[model samples]
Target: MLQTEFPFTLPCGYVDARGNLHRQGTMRLATALDEIEPLQDARVRANEAYLTILVLSRVVTRLGDLHPVDVRVIEGLFSADLAYLQRLYVQINEVGTTLFETQCPRCGLRFSLDLTEGGDINDASAGL
Candidate 1:
């Protein structure tokens, strides 16, 4: 099982047409589950970080007019968000049940096992 954590905070600001800065209360951001899964995969951690930056770039594009500092802040927040998502997937897998397919070491016969909600092993074809 993998355990991870991430923290994030939104900043207050937006750029004006005259290149002036204005103070704002909060910013709205959309997060997707699919976008965060690769981040959870240990083999692709570096790639995940790069993908997160791409997603942040899309957010900045949507904002239309944001100062460079604001973009940096947003990037930090998105990174934290990705980490949080990774932690969530780990917790879910820890509690959820899974079915396993196995082969007999003696005869090479394939068999399936079902894991109950409580993690007990049972023959997958018992009810069939």
Candidate 2:
């Protein structure tokens, strides 16, 4: 059976308090309860945008040199990394597959990008 979790690299990476650069991490697919429970958090309720940080902390299990990921870790991530993980969370859980459709407005080209374990995000050109 394939693992429901997937590994990813932060676009800008995270820097710990000790100045260690942490880039690689794993995120598991979100369950209904996972999405629902965060809504009850006072922090998430106070800052709607903070929901992403909360959601991410729950799914991200590990990061470079960080055996046990925590909320503070997610809170310390760079904005670019936060965005990347948000997209990744959607890609893995809600998108429901390893491939997604993309388009280039300049050329009116629509293509499918593979998001599987070994595929690259920019490696897409298949016609639907």
Candidate 3:
């Protein structure tokens, strides 16, 4: 089955107006509509940047103590944090569950790694 939920930490983090820092969160995999629906928003048409804001808002289920993640939270993210989310979105939606697989040259044992949680084998912690 396709893994649906993904966890991540922001590079710079999002600081709310209350001064609370939101660094960790869970982002669910985007469906076709999750990506396509934003293109129809007037704000997205007016300012292309809002497309990502909307898309991220829809996929991010939680961030730190914040409940019911919203567009306001996405709009408040730092540029670095935004970039991290964008990368993660692509990684989850495009690259997918199996990041890579190989067989040990010496032992000849095959193994595969699933990155749907937070990261791939390249950087299991994927602090990016």
Q: After superposition, how far is residue 52 of candidate 2 from its true place, in Å?
A: 0.9
lDDT agreement with native, every candidate = 0.39, 0.78, 0.77
Candidate 1 Cα deviation (angstroms), residue 17: 17
Lowest lDDT sum, 10 consecutive residues, model 3, at 119-128
Residue runs of model 1 more than 4 Å from their true location after superposition:
1-9, 12-45, 62-64, 67-128
**Compared to the true structure, candidate 1 yields what TM-score?**
0.22
TM-score of each: 0.22, 0.76, 0.74
lDDT tens digits, residue span 1-128, model 3: 86688766676777888888987788998888998999999999999988999999999999999977999888888888898788778777885335533334577444445545764455334432
Residue-wise C-alpha lDDT for candidate 2, range 18-77, written one tens digit per residue: 999998778888888878899999998899998888888888989997967889999998
Q: Write the candidate numbers in order of decreasing TM-score.
A: 2, 3, 1
Maximum-TM-score candidate:
2
Q: Rank the candidates by lDDT, best first.
A: 2, 3, 1
Report the candidate with higher lDDT, 1 versus 2: 2
TM-score of 2: 0.76
